[model samples]
Target: MEVEGLSVVYKRARDRAGAPDAAAVRDVSFSLPAGQTLALVGESGSGKSSVAMAILSYLPAGARREARVLRLGPHDLLAAGEGDLRRLRGRRIAAVYQNPGMALNPSLSIGRQVAEILEVHLSLPRAEALRETERLLGEVQIREPRAVMDLFAHQISGGMQQRVSIAMAMALEPALIVLDEPTTALDVTVQRQTMDLLADLQRRRGTSYLLITHDIHLASVHAHEIAVMRAGEIVETGTYAQLRDDARHPYTRQLLGSVLAKDPRPEARPGAPAILKVEGLEHGFSKAKRGRPAVEDVSLVIKAGETLGLVGESGSGKTTIGKLICGIHDRQAGAIELNGRALPTQFDRRGPSDRGAIRMVFQSPDATLNPAHTIGAILRRALAIAGAGDPKAEAAALMERVRLPAALESRRPAELSGGQKQRVAIARAFASSPRLVVLDEPTSALDASVQKEILALLVELQKERTVGYLLITHDLDVVAEMAHHVAVLKAGRIVETGATRRILSAPEHGYTRELLASRLVPPAATAPARPGAARDAPWSAVSQLA
Candidate 1:
């Protein structure tokens, strides 16, 4: 399969009148070698995902995509009929998305889904399909293939689901597979394993890959060729070493320099005792039927003005543990102590004192905030809850702390960008001058420059008063920036714990090493959506939901 001078584009609202014309992707020309991966690296919306979506024949619900030429070997892609495209889809080209849980059908067992794909694309009998499915699952390194196949998508861990997605894509053994942020949701070790698996597959099957991601390190490690896109154009295309050694674009340089290399807070002056402590922390979901613990036997301590970094992959129980601490979820077992006093596990059961003393800033800033709630209301709610200051004064002060405009309080949460929402969350988290703040993926959603600003803000906050942070995140760079103490969590267990410098710079566990390797920050990476593209692209009625 090969593509030459391939250009694909789309308009979000072609179906509606007065809708602006937005070109999602444009003038993107590249080739797919028989076995090598041509990675498209860029920030979000850089058209890297757009290119993959186009190649998959799955543009957003409504978008006008124009491609000069989309060819698979001797066959013309853009010209293929619906039936012809369908025939070639699973049999010739398969896609492995970033979130496999969302992609997989929840009601069906893993074995059934894999078998169905095989039956559809390979025309195999059900019994033979089941046998092949087990082999496929085993090939992806899923332990107890029989058990995994019997379980539904909701029953399996995120890493296993991702591996199953890879297996499904490879079941038919397509010539091309597009991996869209394939390892974005996993811990460092899981990410490394997935990358290795993809590389190994390419070596054996000679399948071509089009990897779309923002992690320059992942691209450098896995891809044979790299395309740096900005706005809707390719700014540079070469080997990772080529771009790394002598990058030419300012945007590229910014990405490379934005690493925010980590060192423990130099002005470290330790004070205060344990700000928060949990003994035998355990929790799980289930009231109607039998259930298993998501987080079991978890215990940790955080000192005043220190950051306790809890690092783990998706579904590693890191977020669950943070939620348990934050009062979002009820703790099934264990004692949560704040300032040496035990607090109620349930959020609603917790008294006003608990609410005021321990606060939480959630992971998904967008999801945590209400679209209709104005920034003022968000901050004011905290002020009102804790009765900290005059509502108006506190609102104004909070905005100032987050470096946001005071007037934005009138605007709803939807009006703010990812970075802005995060600041707003931080402002609200600190509204009552809480003793301890649980920051989950605080800087994951922000741009590199914006991340620097947020990290610097945290430093200022720590210096101003006694505040502790239980920062649960998958980002290693962030751990380096803000964490004083670090605890690595894997599969609901703390595998390693030490000072931030010791754990991150020189990891002892194999899992820690893999995370570091997968997380090596590259000085530069490709651009997204081509450089200088309008942030607000032409709108279509069929915009992406969530």
Candidate 2:
């Protein structure tokens, strides 16, 4: 596959100055033979993903208005008609994404989703499709393939859903596939496994890949070669050893530098009072089929004016516990107390005033916001609910707090970007002026550069307000930088817990240690912190790793 003289650009309206919109891609050039992998790496708008999508012949119709030349697998993608290209996808090539929600049909069962692909692409009969789907699931190491297939997309866990997507992608055994941040949203072990699976498949089937991602270190783990893109062009391309050993481009060095930067837990005084606490917490959902609980017998704590990071694989009850505390989900059996008060195990029983102390920020800001309402109204409602002072004034203040312009108030949710929506969500969460905030992977939806800005904003908020944070995430690297306390949960149990310093530096539990190692940044950069006036940086505990 090769792309030559590619020149994709976009034209947008200009101000009185009348300057043309910048080119989204420019004179991009690259080629890959069969049985090898190449990566396109850059920031959100850098056109890395666009090049891959263009190569895969899957650029959305609207984007074709700008693409100049794109060729792949015996077809000139820049000129392929809709019908011709539609027939090519999933037969000779396929693509997987960071989010399963984007690719998997929400209402369909896993069995039907996987089976239909094989049926459509490979001309398999119904019985044969079912058998092939099962085998495919097994090939990806999905436990309980039979029962898992019967489950709905939402019924299965995120990791399993990812595996299902992979199984479907591999069903046709295509000559090549494009993976766009396939494991970005998963935990360390799951990421390691996914990479292992991809490696094994490439060896077994000789399937070439054009992997698009922002992760620099892991690029070394999988690809035979890497092509770093910047400003819509390939600035650097070399083998893992060649690039890491001789990283020349300033941008390439920055990307590598990021991997080794120490993200010590969010700064907080070690002696500060506890902001949130839980004792013998228990929560469970009714099983559709039988005895297992969705979340069972979990316990944890969060210090006042500090961040408590919750670490767990998907469906390991990390988010559920966060939800239970914030009154988003009912707890079947448990005790929940905020700031030492006796609260219900469930939200319904919790008093109106009590609920005001804790707030939740969901992952998908787009789905959570009301499309019809303006940004101001959404935040205003949150302030009103929590009885914050001068709701309108607070809403405007919140917009500023999240680093968003108050002028965006009149625009509806549709007019906003993903990062903007999340900024609004954070503003809403803080609108109540809650003592504690439940951040449910707030930055996961953003790209690397945007992610840093959000994290910096979050730390600023914590420092200013002295609010506690219950940070629930699958990404441990985030925890290393953001949490003052660490709780590693696996299979509905607290596998490890302690001071952020001790836990991360000298984890006693095997799981905790593995999590730390996965998130471990190589030793190179010094701690970048504001050095709060509150106290010394007691929570900056990289020594735990040392």
Candidate 3:
């Protein structure tokens, strides 16, 4: 596949006179050789996805595509007719999207979905397609493919759903695969495993890959040639070593620097008092078929002006534990004490003062925030609930704390970017001036550079307010950087607990070691020297979120 001088522009629904029309991707050029991977790296809105969509002829309506030359094999992609492109898409070139939840049909069985792909592209009989679907599932390392095929999308785990998505993409075994941020939402261990599966398949089948992501570390490890994109243009393109050792562009250097730097703040503040404590924490969902507790025997403490990092894989009870302490879930058997006073198991039983003392910043800001309400209105509501004087004054102060412009208070959640929305969520949490805040994957949805800014703001807030944070996340590098102490959770229990540095440098548990080993940054000594090199990075920045 080869592309030169490719450009794309989206026609506005209602364009006025003198309105500037900007191309999403402009004059981009690259060649993805057969049996090799080319990764396009950039932040969100950098046009990486636009280029991929253009190559697949999957651009949305109202988007115009232009290119000097865009060829796959002997065919010109830009000039291909709709019918030809449709036939070529699944039979010759395929794509795997980012979110399996959104990609998969919830109402359809996993087996039916995968089999449908085979049936449509290959025109195989239903029985033959079903059999092939099982084979594809097995190839992707999905355990008990026959049983899994009968389950719905919601019935399976996130990692499993992602594998199913990959299996669907590989149904026809196309010549090229466009993987757009395939493992961005997965846990570190799962992400590594999925990548390993892709690499193994590529080796065996010689399928070329065009990986589009914001993770520089992942691009360095998996891509044969790395293209650093900025504002729809390719700023630099070279091998991982060439870009890593000597980045020519300023943006590339900035990306490299952000990936390299870990924990800008000092570690371990001595002699701080415990602000929040949990004793004999135990809870389980009644409807759980596996019978394992969602949270079991979990005990930890968050000291004032410090962070307690809770790290684990998805379904390992990290978020469950956070929700339990923050009054979102009732504890089955445990004591949650905030500053020497015990908190009610249910939030409704707690008094206004008790409720105001402990706050939570959820993983997805869009879920917590109302689209209809302005930022100021959300902040004012929280202040009113806390019985704070002057909602308007407090809202302004909260916005200032989060480093958001005061004028943004009038805008609704839809008006803000992902980063800005997150800051609003943070500000809302701090409206009550809580002593302890439960930060549940606060930076997970943000871009790398924006993640840095949010982290810096969080640390700065900690410095000013001496607030304690219960940081629940699957990201170990974040634990190392932000948390003073770390607790590793698995199957609703603590696998390891100690100082962040001690746990990271020399983890006693095998799972802990595996988690660290699964980081996305490749080591220097064993770096691959070939164009089609395949390796892994140290456990660090995987995608947009550094």
Candidate 4:
């Protein structure tokens, strides 16, 4: 596959007359050789997805694309009609999206979904397709393929859903697969397993890959070549070693610098009073599901101005513990104390002061922010709920404190950038001047640079307000940089707990070791080598060894 001088522009109806139309992708060019990977690394809005859409001829309506040369195998993507592109898409070219839960049909059984792909693409009969679907699921390392076939997507784990999506994509053995932030939503261990599966599949099938992501470290580990993009253009392109050792572009250097930089903020003052504490926490979604409590005897503490990171894989109860602390979920058995006072188990039972003092920020601001209301309105409402003296003035001050411009106050969340929206969320969380905040995977969806900025802001705010933080995330790098202490969770149990540096540098638990090993280390810190060679093994073999 090859592309040259590719440019894409979104024709917005709001554009002023005679104004210059900015292109989302400006003169982007790259080539992917068979059986190799080319990673497009950039921040959000950097046009990596635009390039993918252009290649697949899947751009949205009102979007215009042009290229001097665009060729995929023998077909000219530029010249291909909708019918031609449709046929080529699932047969020779395929795509795996960021969130498999959204990609897979929640209403359909996993078996039927994968079987339908086989039936449509390969013209197999229902029986043959169903049989093939099971084989494909097994190939992707999903256990009890037959059992999974009967279950819907919602019944399965996120990692399984992703594997099902990949199984569909791999059904026809496509020549080029576009992985658009494929593993971003997964936990570290699951992410490593997923990537390893992809690598092994590529090795066996000799399929080329176009990996689009904001993580330069991930690109360095997985791709044969790396392209750094910023503001819709490729600023630098080279092997990881070349770019890491000598990055000519300042943006490229900035991106590298932002990858898990050591937290420079002063440590929390020694002997600071404990702001939040949990003891003997236990919660279960269903008593019928024996031996698997959602949260089992979880316990941790956070002092004023300090962060306690809870690290684990999906379904390890990190978020469950956060919800329990925030009073969003009622714990079956536990004691939660804020400033030495026992808190209610349910959010509705909590007093106004209790509610105001313990706030939570979610992973996606898009889900939390109201589209119909302005940023000022959102902040003001939060302030009003907290019974602030003056909502209007406090709203503006909150925006300013979060480093957002006052002009954005009148704009709705849809009008703000992702980072800006997150800042607004943070500001709202602080509206009550809470003593503690439960941050649940707050920066997982953001780009590396934006993530660093957000973390820095959190540190600054913690220092200023002396607020304690319960940081729940799957990224160990984040734990290394943000947390003063760490707790490792597996199967809904705390397996290890210690200082951040000690847990990351020398973990005692096998699960913690696996999580650390899976994280993508910056190229400068590790020996120059590709990850594919080491990871090129069938998932069955790897899982058995585990």
Candidate 5:
């Protein structure tokens, strides 16, 4: 597969007679040899995805695509008719997107979803397709293929769903597979295993891959060749070693410098008062059918101006613990104390002041922030609830604190970028002037540069307001940098707890060791003694333009 001089432009909605068009991809060129991987590395909206879609003939509606040459094996994708493109899409060229849940059919049985691909593309009999589906699942290293086939998409773990997506993509032994941020949503252990699975599949099937991601470390470890893109153009291209040792471009160098970098903030003072405390916390969905607790005897403390990171794999009860702290979930057996006073188990029982003191920033801002309301309206509502003297002034101040533009207040959530929406969420959380905030994977879904900015913002806010943070995340590196203390959770239990540096440097528990080992460290750096050894793309002015 090959592409040369690819350009994509989208016409924006015209309030006036003439509005400037957006160029998503411009003059981009790359080639992937059969059975090899070519990684496209950049921040969000850097044209990596646009290039992939151009090759797949899946550009968004009303977007104009122009390329000097675009070829997939023997087919000319640029000149192919719609019917031909449709026939080739699933049979020869396939794609696996960032979120498997969005792609998989939740209502359909996993077997039926996998089999439908074969039945439609290969015209296989139902029985034959079902058998093939089971075989494919097994090939993807899924145990109990038959049992899993009968389960719905939501019934399985995120890792399993992602593997199923990969299986479906490889159902017809496609020549190329487009993996767009495939492992971003997964846990560290799951991500490592999934990448290993992809490597194994590529070796066995001789399948070429176009891996699009903002994670440069992932690309360095996984791809044969890496391409660094910025502002819709490829600025650098080479092997990991070639680029790492001496990055010609300033942007590339910045990206390399941000990897595994340590937090720049000073240490928290000793003996800070515990703002929030949990004792013997235990909770489960069902009392009658429970084998193990959803959160088992979990106890933790968060001091003022400190961050206590809860790190674990999916279903490890990290989010549950966060919800328990914020009074979102009732604790069956536990004691929660805020400022030396026992707090109510349910949010409804909590007074307005109690509720205001413990605001939460949900992971998905889109779900929390109403799309129908403008940014200003959202902040104003929070201010009204908090009883701020001046709602409008306070809202503007909150936006300024998050480093968001004043004009953004008029735009709705849909008009903002992921980072911008997150900033708005942070602003809303701060509107109540909370002493403690439950931040659930606040930067997990964002690009690395944007993640850094958000982290910095959180740290700055902590310093100024002395707000405690209950940060729940799967990224160990983030835990290392942000958290004052760390807790390793598994099967709804706390397996280990200690200082962040000590836990990261030398973990006592085997599970903790496994978690650290599973981190996506670059092969070139045996041990990143300092930060920035395995950094993602560097912060760029152009990156914020997204």
Candidate 6:
């Protein structure tokens, strides 16, 4: 596969016609030999994904693409017509997206989704397609492929859903596969397993891969060649060792440096007052098979100015426990207390004070923030609901506290970057002066540099306000950086609980050990410790480039 001088531009909307058109990809060029991987590494909005979309002819409407030469195998991609591109898409080239849940159809059975590709591409009979589908599923390491055929996507675990996605991508044996952050949302163990499956399949089939992601560490371990993209252009390209040791471009060095920067773990404040407490918490979803409990016998405590990391795999009841405590889900059996006062089981049942004292931030800020509302309006509404004396001034103050510019107050959520949107979400969470905040996978979608900045902001806010945090995440690295105490949860039970350093360094539970083993550390972490190169660099250095 080869590309040279590829550029993509999207037309501005009529209302914004006065502004210049957006250049998503600018003069990007790269080559990937058969059976090798080339990684496009950058933060969100850096044009890595635009290059992929342009190659696959999958750009959205109003987008214009131009290229000097774009060829894959014997096909001239640039010359292919719409009909030709359609036939070539699933057969010669395939794509696996970041989120499998969004990529897979919820209403369709997993078998049908996988088999349809075989039938369309290979023109196989119904029975033969189904048989091939089962084989493909098994090849991707899914247990009981036959039984899984009848199950809908929602019925399977996230890892299994991703496996099904892989099966679909592999059904036609495409020569080139574009993996866009394929394992970003997965657990550490699941991520390792998924990558291993991809490697094994590549070894067997000699398929080339174009990996697009924000994780320099992941790209370092996976890609044969790495290209650093920033602000719609490729700034540098080389092997991981070359880029890591002697990068010439400042942006490239910043990306590498961000991954290597380590933060000191917050010390446990033994004398801090307990901000929130849960006892004998239990909750079960009605849709669950056999009425199984989603979370059972869960009990934890968070102290003022401290964070408690809840680590686990998908469906391990981490989010369930968080929701139960926040009154998002009514607990069947449990007791929640704030400052030694029992709280209501449901959010609506609680008084305004209780609601104001506890707040939660979801994983996807896009889903939580109303697209129709401006950032200032959202902040002001929260302040008014909390009975602030001056909602307008307090809203601006909240924006300032979150490190956002006051000018962005008028912009809607759609106008903000992922990092900016998350900052808004954090600001909204603090509007009510909450004593405890439940942060669910807050940094999973962000790039390494932005993630560090956001974490630093959270720490600063905690110090100023003495707020407690219940951080739920699968990223152990994040846990190490943020949490004072760590609790390992599996099947709704706490298998181990202790200091973050002790649990991460020396775990008592086998499950905890497995999670630790699956974590991917940067090469710098294992090498001789060097001074942090980007620690002193302003956050805007990365943010503006992104």
Q: What are the RMSD figures for all models against the true structure?
A: 6.8, 8.8, 4.2, 5.6, 4.6, 5.2
lDDT of 3 at 493: 94
> Per-prediction count of colliding residue pairs?
19, 6, 6, 0, 8, 0
The digit string of per-residue lDDT tens for model 4 on 1-546 reads: 888888899875674666666689988777777888888999899899999999988888889999988998998988989889878988999999999999999889999998988888789999999999999999999999999999999999899889999999999999999999999999888888999899999999999899999998788888877888888888888778778888888999999888875542335689999988899999999878877789988888899989999988888899999999998888999899999999989899989999999999999999999999999999999999999999999999999999999999899999999999999999999999999999999999999889999998998998889999999999888887789898999989999998887787788989888888887765554555465443332211000000
Which regions in candidate 4 have their CA more than 4 angstroms from the true location?
Answer: 14-22, 262-267, 286-291, 524-526, 532-546
Clashing pairs in 6: none
**lDDT of every model, 2 decimals:** 0.78, 0.75, 0.85, 0.88, 0.87, 0.87
lDDT of 6 at 19: 97
Alpha-carbon TM-score of each model against the true structure? 0.86, 0.81, 0.92, 0.92, 0.91, 0.93
Per-residue error (Å), model 6, residue 7:
0.4
Model 5 sits at a Cα RMSD from the real structure of 4.6
Query: Which residue runs does candidate 3 get wrong by more than 4 Å?
Result: 13-19, 260-267, 287-290, 529-546
* Runs off by more than 4 Å, candidate 6: 260-266, 524-546
TM-score winner between candidates 1 and 6: 6
Candidate 2 residue runs with Cα over 4 Å from true position: 7-24, 65-69, 73-88, 101-138, 143-156, 229-263, 287-289, 344-353, 385-394, 513-546
Task: Give me the displacement of residue 244 in model 1, in angstroms.
Answer: 1.4
1 or 3, greater by lDDT = 3
Tens-digit per-residue lDDT, 1-546, candidate 6: 888888999999999969999998888777777877788999999899999999999999999999988999999999999999989988999999999999999988999998888888889999999999999999999999999999999899989999999889888889999999999989999999998889889889988889999998888777766889998988888767678888989989888877633343857667998989898898888854675588888888889999999999988999999888889999999899998999999999999999989999889999999999999999999999999999999999899889899999999999999999999999999999999999999999999888888888998999899999999999988898889998899998888998887887789999999998998865453442211212222211011122
Candidate 1 lDDT tens digits, 270-388:
66688889889988776664554778889999988888899988777998988888888888889989888888878888788788778788767888887888888878887998786
What TM-score would you give candidate 6 relative to the actual structure?
A: 0.93
Clashing pairs for model 4 are none
Model 2: per-residue lDDT, tens digit, 293-342? 76767777777778888888777888888888877787777777677886
